[model samples]
Target chain A: MLELKNVSAGYGESSVLKGVSTTFEKGKLTSIIGKNGCGKSTLLKSILGILPLSSGKVVVDGNNLHSMSRNEIAKKVAYLAQGKSTPDMTVEQMVLHGRFPHLSYPRRYQEADREIARKAMGVVGIYHLADKPLFTLSGGTRQNAYIAMALAQDTDYILLDEPTTYLDIAHQRELMNLLVKLANRGKGIITVMHDLPLAFNFSNTVAVIQNGTVVAHAEPSEICGSSVLDEVFGVKIERLPNDKFYYDY
Target chain B: MRCYMKSLPKNKIANIYGIAILLLILSAVLGVLLGASGISLTDMLSSLVKGDIESPEVKILLYVRLPRILSGLICGAALAVSGAVVQGVLANKLASPSIIGVNAGAGLAVILCSAFGMIGGWSLSAFAFIGAFLTVMLVSIAAKKWGASRGTVILMGVALNALLGAISDTVITFNPDVSVMSNDFKIGDFSSVTYAELIPAAVIVLITFLVLITLSNELDVLTLGDENAKGLGMNTSLMRVVFLLMSALLAGAAVSVCGLLSFVGLLVPHAVRRMAVTESKHLIPLCALFGAGFVAVCDTLARVVFAPYELPVGIIMAFLGAPFFIFILIRGKGGHRNA
Candidate 1:
């Protein structure tokens, strides 16, 4: 499990996160949903050791994140953001960059490394574009390419910040299905999502944040109830007698 | 078009690198042979193999064009390799050492020293090195405080370039006699160089090339973007400073030898990347070979194109290279970063 304790972080003194604490469990799909600037991304970054916490501690798999090296944390968790503006890298080459933690300095790729990268591309269904330059790929294709890279890292935990922001409906479902499959295989998948319907239907657990703190962490059924929706999002929900779902808009 | 778009089978990029270098060596040899003296290939070979410097033609060839050829190769390689590093580090296609004012800074300092008559007996190179170091220092500070965005770095570079240009021009204007010497020097001549001046400059370029090549992997990570590289455990700021210093050293050394030659650094890497992918592993060696071959070819053409009155290789390169560069840009494929 990845756990954050009183973590505070920001970019150069504008402290976006204020003493937030959360734990992401293994073998589960945990979705974080919040309004704009609610510190969802900041929480993920702090847990992954990308953003240095000002005072508190983060522990991942029993290893203290602050005490360990960046490479060590990289091996434990693979973090993917919404969109990467990388240029000129082939899909295969970008995936191969994930094997960095396994390779030492003067890094070289063995046949096995290529095999893992190929497998990653296969998993993400971008195998055909392995030789295509990343810039030429469409937005959805490029996002999958980065996801394939994170998959190639083969870490225990995968943290994604709005991974489905650019995808069409079909691709959004496809990626959400892929995340469910990854979680089913006993890997922890933590994603910060803005699409409420998709997050409610897909995730095993949802953590709702408001103003830099997680307001509710519970199963989808519990969090999707009318009262929880009204409390978290400040919206009143109506349920029709014939319909099985609650609607809050 | 379908066949063309089929995934390129991975030929070992290193193999291509080796082939390009071999071709460069061959071109450099051919370049050294063809000159105004017109020594026969047979006589040149026999003298070189037999160590018979007794022949005046052989001695002249060995003493004169050999150092000049080596200088061209080294300078070309230095400029191209540094260009690749700077482009990657700044994440800007146009961020060459010259464009960023490192060359002007060194060139100005060298001219200033020569104009003042303070370097009456000293080597021009030490002054060039100091200028180069200062330029890198100034640019680094600017890149930090101002941020190394594509717009900011280039604007700062242009501003610094204008300042250096004005200072150099003012020094020349104030001292006309020294201006004549500086003008002759500024035409980018390699003909009259002594072994003393050539050896140290060559060494500096080689050392800088080695340093840059060693950091090619870091450069690969760097080009992805600063945040990505930092998350991958690289100290991004430190790497940028080191890269700028190396580029300055290389450009400064080249200027000390051949004055300010433009377009080789800018053109060579872009050309290499256009033909190949943008991976630094392939990019660096291909650049070295192509840079050496390019300058060698341009220098040869400069010598023979208007025989008895050699054109400056710089003028020839810009005249020849600029249009091709514009064509690449206009074709809407300035390689991946620009697109």
Candidate 2:
């Protein structure tokens, strides 16, 4: 479990996350939904230690995150950031980089590391693209390649930030389904989502942020019963047939 | 060790290395034999292989031609690899030692050293490395602070290059005694290179090259950009500093010996990338070999084209490099962050 306790962080002159706090449980998919620039991404960055906490603490499995080295944090958590560059690296090479935290100094990939990356590539179904550069692949395929790299990291928690922003509808559904599958496989999946219907339907838990503070943290079913959704987004969640959902403005 | 990357398989890299080695040999031979009074290959070979140094022609081969050729090999490799690393770490295709004012910084330091009568190879190279390192850190920090665009970074480099050049000129104006160095230094000629200058720079380049090769894979991770690299557990800022330091050392050493041989850093890496060799393990070593030979070839051309009135090797580079750079830019493959 990863826990953020009264954490506050910000850019140089302006505070973005003001006393934000949350808990991420293992073996579940949690979605953070918010309006644009509501500090959803900033929340994730603070958890990853990419942003320094002005006050308060981030605790992961009883270990204080501030005291842990980046290597230690990485061994327990993986990240999939948005707007990834299309570098001149093959899928296998990209995936293999997930083993970075596992290696020692003068780090070189071992045969065992290769075996793990291969398994990760297989998990994301990019095994056959081992030699293909990411730039040549389609957007969906490239996203899968990055996910494969995260999987190769083999951490208990995987955090994604606006991963579906550029994908088509079908690809978005496919990615959400993949996240569900990973969650079922006992990995903690935390993602910042934009699609309200998808976030409410696919996620086991939804945390709604309004102006850098989470206003509602509840189970998906509980979200509809509260007035927070309408109060924040001015929308109502309507359940559809076959475990589907719709947002009515 | 036996892994395979696409198109550039291990065997293919081996073949490329083979060609690079052969080219280096051929260019070294040409450099040795292309001076004002040309020595035949046979006589050159006998003078070299037999270790005969009594004759003036053999003395020329031993003293002047040999040191110059050595400078071409070592310093060229340093500059080219420096360019490759700069491009990688910055995630900009257009970033090179010369373009980003690294060479200019070193050139300024060299002028200062000469003006101060600090003419020893060790002190000169140390000053050069310090100057190069500080300038790179300045550009890098300014870019980070302002969130500089690719074009803005290049503009900064141009501004720094002009400013440093003016400083060098002013220093030379006051210290007329150092005017000789400033004159040959601007165009980057290797004719006056000596063992005192050559040895220290060569040592620094060699050591830095080995260290870079060891860290090549980390560099590839860095090119993936900061957020992802940090996610992968790399200390991004620390690694960036380390890599930039190595790059500065390389450009500084090259400038220490060869006096700002322009465009080899920019040109060699661009050519290497065009060949689809992006992995740093292969890219770094290949750039070294290819760069060494490429500079030797250009230097030979400089010597042979005018015979007695030799042009600086930098002129040949400009003629070749400017066109190629323009072509790549126009083609929308400016080696941008698009990979």
Candidate 3:
């Protein structure tokens, strides 16, 4: 389990996350949703240790994240950043980089590492495009390739920042399904999302952040029943009779 | 479905390695045999086997041509590998040692040392290394201070190159006694390289190559930008500094020996990337082999084309490298990253 207790973090001169406490349970898909500039991404970075916490502690399985080396943290948690540049590498090469923390000294990838990368690519359904350069792949397929890279890390927890951005509706649905599948495989999957319906439908737990603090942390049903999203986003969310949702600004 | 997506077949890479080694050998042999006093292949082989330094043929081969040939091979490989690492670390294809002020900086230091009559042996190379390292550090610091974008860094390098070139010219002007020597050094020639001058550089280049090859995997991960690399558990800043120091060591060592040779660093890496895999492990070795061959052949041509009146190898490299650089610019491959 990864837990952040009263954490505050931000860029220079401007705080984005303030005293936000949250726990991401293992084997569950947790969706972080909030308005733009509401510290959704900042909170993720704080937990990943990419951003230094201004106050408070982030603990992973009873060990303080701040006390561990970057390599140690990477061994337990994998991260997929949003909208990476297209490196001049094939999907297989990109996925193999995930094994970096596992190897030492000369850092040669052994047969076992290759097998794991291949399996990770298979999990994301990009096994067919492994040899193709990432620049040649479609946006959605590229997203899948990055996911394959994250999966290849073989960690218990994976964090993604807006994995669905720039992806088409079909690709978004496929990615959400893949995330849920990964969560079902006993990995804690945490993602920052903008799509309310998809987050509500797919995630086992929903964390709603407003003004740099998490105002609501509950199950999808409980969040949907409350007025959290409407209050945070300054919009009216209506639940239709047919089990669909509509948002009116 | 188990789809095996192999990027480049193993045989193809093996073939590339084979071709590169063969070319290197061919160029090396030609470099030795085609110098001013031509020695036939059989004669050269017999001289090598006889091991008689007293014989005129053996003396010329051992004392004169052998060091020049070795210098070309080592310097060419050094510059090319340095360029490839710089390009990878900066994530910019245009980031060669020559273009990024490393060669010019080393050249200024060597010229300054010569002007002060502090020439020869390890001291000159040490001075050159310090100059190269300082220039790279300055450029990186300035770039970081001023937004640190790819374009910004390249522009800063250009500015630094111009400044260093001007300083070199000033140093040469004040010391007219060393004017002729400075001119030859500026254009880059291997005729003056003796064994005494070549040994230190050779050792540094060889050791640096070995160390870099061991870290090639880390270099590949570094090309994926900082945040991503850190996410993969790499100390990205530390690796960048180490790579930059290695680049300086290579450029400084080569410049200290052969003056300021241009474009082998820029051209060889680009050419190798076109033919083989982009992975640094494969790219670094292939660049070393192909680069050695390319410069050796170019040096041989420079020696033979003008007959008794030899041209510096830099002229030939410039003629080739300038056009390719422009082509890269026109093709929009020079600046790949917005940052």
Candidate 4:
């Protein structure tokens, strides 16, 4: 479990996350949904220790996030930031980088590391695209490559920020299904989602942020038919059968 | 065609390495054998075989052509590898040693060293590295602070390059006594190179390059960008600083040896990339080899193209690099692939 204790973080002088207290449970896919500039991404970064918490603590299991080294923290959790650019390298090389946190200085990618990477690529079904350069692949395939990289990190918790942003609907759905699959395998999958209907329906729990604070954190059905989504996102969401939902546009 | 579309596989990259080594060897042989000396390659080889090191041909081969050729290789490799590193770390394609003020920084340092009297080779290289390190760090920090975009970083580099060049000119103007500030040095020539000057710079470049090669994987991870690199547990800031420092060392040592040889850094890496050499392990070593061969070949042309009256090697580089840079711009690959 990753727990945030009254976390406050921001860029330079302007505080973005004004005391955002939240807990990301293990073995479940949690979706953080918020309006633009509501500190949803900022909150994820804070949890990953990518953005320094101004006033609170990020506790992973029992270890404090800030006290740990980057690698040590990486061993505890993996992160996938938004807007991943395609670098010039083979997909296998990209996946192999996931084994980076496991290596020490004078970092070597040994056979074991290669095995792990191969396993990761297999997990995301990108094993066939292993030899292909990342830049040549389509949006969905590239997202899989990146997710494969994250999976290769082999951490208990994997955090992604808007993984579906630039991808098309089909790719987005494919990515959500993959995330759900990973979550089903008992990995703690936490993603900052922009697609409200997808987030509320697909994730095991939904974290709704308003003005840098999580105004509602509960099971999607528990928050359904409530006024929180309307107040926070300024939209109405109708819950459908079988725990699915749609925006009342 | 498929090979051109993607990063080369290990064996293909090795094959390219094979080609690069051949080019370097051919350039070195030509550099040693084809000067203004009336002595033939046969004469020099036969003399060395006979242990007759006193011959004028052998002396020229051993002393003049050899040092010049060696320094060309060292300087060329240094600059090119450094350029590859800069391009990777900053994740900008337009940034190179010359554009990013590294050459100017080292040029200023060399000029200052000359003004202080012709100091030892080590101190000159050290001063050059210090100067280059400072300039690049300033540019990097400023870019970070401003949250400069990919193109913005290159623009910042252009501005810094111009600023540093102006300062160098000012220093040169003030200290006309400094011989290194003369036209030949500014344009980058190996005509006056000595063993004392070449050895120190060579040592630094080689060592720094090897260190960079060991950290090449980190460099690859770095190109993944700050957030991903940190997510992968890399200390992004530290690795960036280390890479920048190594790059400075390389640019400095090369500049210390041969004034400011522009475009070897700019040209060789781009050319290597066109060959589909993407990762730093392949990128750095290959750049070193190709850069060395390319500069050696250029310097030989400078020496013999006009015969006794030699043009500076920098002229050849400019003649080549400027056009190639334009071609890249026209093709719209001048920015980062995704940028």
User: What are the TM-scores, per candidate, against the unseen true structure?
Assistant: 0.89, 0.94, 0.94, 0.95
Give the CAPRI class of candidate 3. Answer: medium
lDDT string, candidate 3, A55-77, tens digits: 99999899898798988889988
lDDT of 1 by residue, A61-168 (tens): 777877977777777888886546666668888887777667776677677878888888887888899888988888778888888888888888888989899789
Task: Kindly report which residue stretches of model 1 are placed more than 4 angstroms away from their true locations once superposed.
Answer: A226-232, A236-248, B1-8, B11-19, B46-55, B112-130, B133-149, B173-181, B184-187, B331-339
Spell out the clash pairs found in candidate 4. none
Cα deviation in Å at residue A27, candidate 1? 1.9
lDDT of 1 at A81: 60
Candidate 2 stretches with Cα past 4 Å from truth are: B1-8, B44-51, B180-183, B323-339
Who is ahead in TM-score, 1 or 3? 3
Interface RMSD of each: 5.0, 3.4, 2.3, 5.6
* Clashing residue pairs found in predicted model 1: none
> DockQ for each of the predicted structures, in order?
0.32, 0.55, 0.56, 0.53
Q: Cα deviation in Å at residue B54, candidate 1?
A: 5.9
**Candidate closest to the true structure, highest lDDT:** 4
lDDT of 4 by residue, B74-118 (tens): 999999999999988888877888888888898888888888896
- List runs of model 3 lying over 4 Å from the truth: A241-244, B1-8, B45-50, B178-181, B321-339
Which order, best to worst by TM-score?
4, 2, 3, 1
Candidates in order have lDDT scores of 0.77, 0.87, 0.85, 0.87
| Model 4 native-contact share | 0.66
